[model samples]
Target chain A: MMRRFPQIAPPLIALAILLVAWELGVRYGFLKPYQFPPVSRIASGFVELSTIGFPTGVSIWSHTLTTLVRVLLGYVGALALAIPLGVVIGSFQVLDKLTAPLVVFCRSVATLSLLPLVIVWFGAGELTKVFLIGYGCFWVMLSNVIAGVRYVDPVLVRAARTFGLHGGELFRRVVLPAALPRIFAGARMALGVGFMVIVGAEMIGTIEGLGALIMEARTFYRSEITIIGMLIIGVIGFAISAGLTALERLLLPWAGNLDAVRR
Target chain B: MLDHDNLARCALRRSEAPVAKRTTSPFLQFIAINSVGKTFAARTGSSISVLDCVDLTIAENEFVSFVGRSGCGKTTLLNIIAGLEDATQGQITIAGRPVTGPGQGQGVVFQQHALFPWLTAVDNVAFGFRKSGLNKTDRRQKAMDLLTLVGLEAAASKYPREMSGGMQQRVSIARALALDPQILLMDEPFGALDELTRIELQHELLRIWEAQRKTVVFVTHSINEALMLSDRIVLLAPNPGRIKRVFDVDLPRPRSRTEPRFNALYEEIWDELST
Candidate 1:
């Protein structure tokens, strides 16, 4: 514990020093409190949003929950469709060659650039937001899944052959396990893309998400509320990523150096 | 020590003995290679011969080693026997039937321990029994038995990466033995280990071979390794690989490197390799 204290102490101290300097700068009039928002104002803003509500009706929790639900629905839906489809496409050479150019072109188009088209097709509603998030996540995930299956170690395939394992048995026993670390890396990357897409996506139509809360606060000249909403979104993003990392570790105990496996 | 010259003469006389025909029973010729050849097509659209007209007969329960330098087709010949690779111009028969593909009861141990990284030692061994009709519990029990035979019962639950190279190789040997193959083909299985570990594994292999009495065809570049384990050593020469010579090692069991006769035979084989 004593040895680990040095490792953890430096980061905490740096963070504390940064927060103190920012607070002092605002309190002494060196910085505008309205624009920058002093720590005290942001703290009060957090309390007010949680209890007295943001727009006199919905609390900060409701906005955060709405944002989270949209992200989850899209993320899970994308993974559900992409994983099986990616596996099939990855396994067959004919299918992979057929779909390669299409997948690359689809992934290249900026996800947010599709916002207007999606809004026109599905209307400016929750479906548009979910569809945008799903679009951002699906291509990233599908490419990773395909690469994972395609690049299994040739030596491992030969090893399995010596055991009389071939075809489906070889794929199941050797290829799948060898490709898992890569697949997990793809999932993590897709989640990050989804998180970034959601924040931008929520700003367009909805007024009940964290993104909209901040946008609305800005229009009303409640800079402190905007600051609080931004902080909450950052925290939620961090939590989601950390949760996924923990889940990956728990599921694949054998997969080492997951970050190194990422392309 | 006896005179080196006398030992050389003795080894030469022993080499002339017809070891392959020692077994009188017709069924004893367990594996027969008849003019086996291998050719690979290059990207330039021309063929390169890897092995040419290789013929040999291995008796049942015999320990034979194929020794040569790189590109000698020793490993290729072993793969052909295992049915992992097809010979271009010849046929190999085991137990009166022609070779087809892997799973005809030929168990192979590669130079690197090829145990599945995701599986624990026991599960890797049990993989050999996947085609067997045993229940899961029974398969685990049998795998445990093979691990015990290889002196690794304690490491049954450990993953491949968690174990040392020697331990990993031991697990691989156990996995191969789990299949109870009629013929065991090992391609330099102990080549990567340190000298002490290699010698230890050689002893362990001899003990297991004595107990199970399975035919073994081992491939190695080490002359001493072949001399230590083989009843007969088939020397292959590269540059269009072909059998150069076959030596019948009539040395007694538990052969020592320090023995003058062993040294003499080693020098002769070393000379053969150089040429």
Candidate 2:
């Protein structure tokens, strides 16, 4: 049924209707200026944040770039540590048993819960924010990597062994490739964790990232800027996920979209 | 360490012996009851016998098949042959030396294709040659050659999902043959394909087999398939699994289901299998 209609038309019309309703509600005094800001006001706010800048000097682009850098740095650090370590734990049953409880406890602990402790240790610097982001991303990635390596089908390993593949050869050829789809899922999840942590971390002590922009705008009653900041954050999150999906497609061409290698 | 050359000479001498004829004439010869058996510990701390006093010799370049229902220890026997599982009771000697574990010219093809999804058809085949003495350029060329032999040259660069079920299994066969093993142990490699694709591949496999002439011990439930492929079929019955019957298929190459002899043997085996 949907195929018969113009593909983009329905969604476009729905979005237009929503914007009109929102704009009219504010103008007619049915909705307040603070909680639910008008679309027109948010549009002006986008322009203001880009040119006039938010919090006096830094523009929206600078804040987005800063946020992006923090997420990337933290995410990369977490993966670098987690992937190898997870492979070690996952490959060995004794090690998996030994660390199972520790991993479970760590993952259950809230990432934001570490914020105060991190600030105390690192003195509220960029290092503290990065550490929190890494901590959150690390656990998520470690678990996924462990799951990836552990869940390799037994048949493939048997097939590999018959071909003179044993020790490192078996692990590299059969286990690693077999576990790739799951490992790719872990990387994607870790990035998301890093993004979420950065937002919460940036809100605390930083004045240069998007989260900070929203906090600053809220205090000054420029709530339209706060709304704009949230939209930008959402857009960035969506783009990052979509980018990772494309990367998965390019790297793991055989993967089905079955979420079998779940995050 | 008397010497590997001396051992090879002894293996050649023993391989020429008469007892090797009853089993098979495959290059990778395995002789059994003089070999050994396997035992498994039950969950209740008791032990169960998987294979007991079981010994069979295979000749060079023979086509053999093992047929049985699930839990009939057919797969366990195959696993033992592949050296994936150790025997608890007896000893197995390949070419006069005791079987230790996997990796002495044994290549495997599985029921599920088991082709690495991330790899293209050519790359998956090449994975078998990773440990080969050949260099990178030669290994790749050899893999491509094998793919061509399997008639998947047109789809050589395609991933497993991009190919048909039959094509993937053909790629799997090519992957197995890439190692140039003396024996190929297949665990229902074509069982998952549809009827049409499966029959087409059966002919394709026959062509490849004629050229390669490797020892093949296939496992399957399809009576016609076993008759069509095997020079000898070993049937096992469950409940403390053991060999039930062995049928020699002497019908001509490229066998037919409609053939009187083919149907007769199928009926005989089917009766034994059901009974």
Candidate 3:
């Protein structure tokens, strides 16, 4: 099994070699340090910021933690609201048709486009950023969930009926479990939307997020800090996505391939 | 030939076997449709009668097959018996009571495998017990038992997608059995499989049926299949479908298609079917 699995090599070694070449290019002045900072410069920038802070006293951990908390709050709230509503809307063709145009229009109205309106309503505080992330995540999650329910194979429903399952029992036992793979896919997509929205939302009114940190570094000509913030954002995105994937595998162990379910 | 009065008496005595009690109730074990007919509205708003005044009685623990070509309303009749659709006229009864809606004694296996892809083989089998007053563990246990009955204990944890086509049909059969209805209704359950798999499943089905001894109403298009599996084969003709003839298959268990008697029955049914 170990031989078949290609157990000797990891992708990290190749990535390290590339990073070294990039750092050398910057050091030899083949590439400008400011436009494209090296790994050493980014690492030093991370250490300096974490110790002395990106702003005056707020550390790098504080910024990342703040962003994580806001996104979590909004994403969880959206899921709690969307799933039931999506099930109801998805199960009924009439309800889906009636809400189709409304859902489309709302999805098209970009979350950032509502930032000005949100500020007027909730002020330029934390509420505005959370609301923006919530707004973005909700529709993407809801649409995918509704589609998941609506598109379930009718053969499964017929099979369930033959078993004497109907009404709520039918929905919970058959419909919901059958729709789970797609719903999990929707959740993964929703998390992505929330992440993107939070970054954009935090760039303006707060210095306590990766987005704010990067923008602040650009203004102070600490380009190295900007690079570190981008890398941190990338790492966070990768980790969150992988976490959701593992969770999906755990919950729906019977799911096959998962190409359609994993966005 | 069986007399009408004798058939009626038989049906009336065993109509409630699967519905009222789990015990070996002699009162309700058969499926009887008395002068039942189905008519559906066409796209042009004209009504098309699918079945007309169809009357049949399948005895307790009998394997009855209904055979006809496509558009012959065989599947429609099975649906009516299953209570999936209401007959436009006449009465259809299972276990003595008129079928108004689904979920009584009718455990139906479709032409398609129809195993739930999301559930493992055992889980799909036991899904019928969802409303059967069984707890989670008990239902799963029953499901496992049914899968074993269908010779699928090894693949109990495998999903529908993971199993072969014949294996999927086996799971579907096991799933229908989980309902534990007095009557098992199959609408061309092996019609979708290849020649080899289909023949293998037919034998597997006979074995399972012999062990379970549930009254069965099977629909198929093939004359050989009907002659091979059924105790009585009901031949129906299209264009306002009605039963043309009912032949009692006297072949013993595991009857071969190459045997003289089997070939004679096949030719007999084929002639009746084609004409």
Candidate 4:
């Protein structure tokens, strides 16, 4: 803990200085109050968001929970579909080749660009937002899962073979475990994609998420609330990724330094 | 002291003699490499011959070494023997049964330690017992025994990346030995290690070989290493790799490098290799 003090102190100090400077700039009229809300206003915005609530009975906690639920649903749905499909596709050369162009085309189509089409299909509801998040997360997760399974080191496979491992036994014992680090990386990346897509999806229709809160705040000219919503999103993202990293460490104790495995 | 020149001449004469005439007992001919040749098709549509009509016989428990420079197809020959690769023109048989594919009682230790990165050292070793029908606890105990043999019992739970290069190779050796194979085929197993580690592994390997009494076919670029460990050294020359000469090392075990006979044999093999 003592050794980490020097490393941890600088970042905390930098953030404090920036916040103080921003507050002073707003108070001194150096920065426009409407454009950049002072530190005090943002702090009050936080308190008001939690206590008195935004718009009516919907508090910041509810908004955060709503966003979390949406992201998790979409992320989980994407993983459920992608993982088995990816493993099967990656195992066979012909399947991988056949789907390559289609996968690439779908990934390149842009998740938000399909917002109008999705809204037209499903209407401006929770399902529309969830579908958009799933679509965005699916492609990223699928590609990563496929690459993970496909590029398992040939040396490892040959080593397994010398012990009489072949076909499904090889796939289960060697290939699956070897592909895990990459698969976990895909999950983390897919979650990030889901998070990004949800914000945009929420902005179009719904006033119960951080994305909707910020968008509504902009229309009401409450820039402080908008800034608070943005900060909450950042905090949520950081917490989620950190949680995932911890989960990965817990599950894959043998996988040292996951970054090294990521292509 | 024996005359070095005379000894060299005698060795050359012995090598020149026909393979069938060299051995007296048919029972000792455990492995037969009958005119084994390998040809790989190049990307440009031409086939490149790697091994050309190579024939050698290994006894049941002989410690033989194939010493040659790079591109000499030493590793290729080892792979062929292991049944990891096929010889386009000929066949290799162990105990009179033809080698069709991998897992034919051949335990191979590669140049690079190929331990599964995700598995612990003990788990990696236990991977060899997949077909043994041993219970998990029994398999683990057996794996621990192999790890102990390789002097890596303390590192049983450690992952491959957690250990040093030498330690990883030790685990790899343990894993290969776990297969309980009839023959041990090593392709420059210690080639990646530092000099000290390499020497240490050489002694360890010798000790293991003495204990296990398994036939070993070791490939290396180092003549001194071959002199230290091998019962006989087979020299292979590059283009369409074929045996150039063979030397019988009759020196005593725990052989000293400074000894006159060891130096003489090293010099003789070095001379043959460079030419």
Per-prediction TM-score: 0.89, 0.89, 0.84, 0.93
- A best-first ranking of the candidates according to their DockQ comes to 4, 2, 1, 3
DockQ in order? 0.44, 0.58, 0.43, 0.65
Give the C-alpha interface root-mean-square deviation per candidate: 1.6, 1.6, 1.7, 1.0
Give the runs in model 2 whose Cα sits over 4 Å from its true position. Answer: A1-5, A254-263, B1-36
Which digits, one per residue and each the tens of the lDDT, describe model 2 over residues B200-229?
988887787788887777888888899989
Q: What tens-digit string does per-residue lDDT give for candidate 4 at B1-275?
A: 23355345435544675422345355677888766777889999999989876778889999999998898899999999988888876678888888988888999898999999888999999988878899999999999999999999999999998999899999999999988999999999999999999999999999999999999999998888999999999999888887777788999899899999999999898897898
Q: Tell me what fraction of the real C-alpha contacts between chains A and B each candidate also makes.
A: 0.42, 0.74, 0.65, 0.77
Scored by TM-score, the top model is 4
lDDT of 3 at A133: 90
In angstroms, give how far residue B263 of model 3 lies from its true place. 2.8
Task: For residues B218-259, write the lDDT of model 3, one tens digit per residue.
Answer: 999888888889998998888888677788899888788789
Candidate 3 off by > 4 Å: A1-21, A27-30, A257-259, B1-30, B34-36, B47-55, B116-123, B130-145, B154-162, B236-248, B268-275
- Of models 1 and 4, which has the larger lDDT? 4
* A1-263 per-residue lDDT for model 3 (tens digits): 77855544566677888999999999888999888888898888888888998797999999999988899888988898888899999999999999989888898888898988999999988988888898898998889889989888887787777777788887887788888988999899999899888867887777788888888888988899888877777888889999989988888877867866575
- Lowest-scoring 10 consecutive residues by lDDT in candidate 3 chain B? B16-25
Cα RMSD over interface residues, candidate 3: 1.7
lDDT of candidate 3?
0.83
Model 4, range A70-188, lDDT digits (tens) per residue?
Answer: 98899999999999999999999899999989998998888999999999999999999999999999998899889889999998988998999999999999899988888899988
Q: Every prediction's TM-score for the first chain?
A: 0.93, 0.94, 0.92, 0.95
Comparison by DockQ, 1 against 2, better one: 2
Worst 10 residues of 1 chain A by lDDT: A254-263
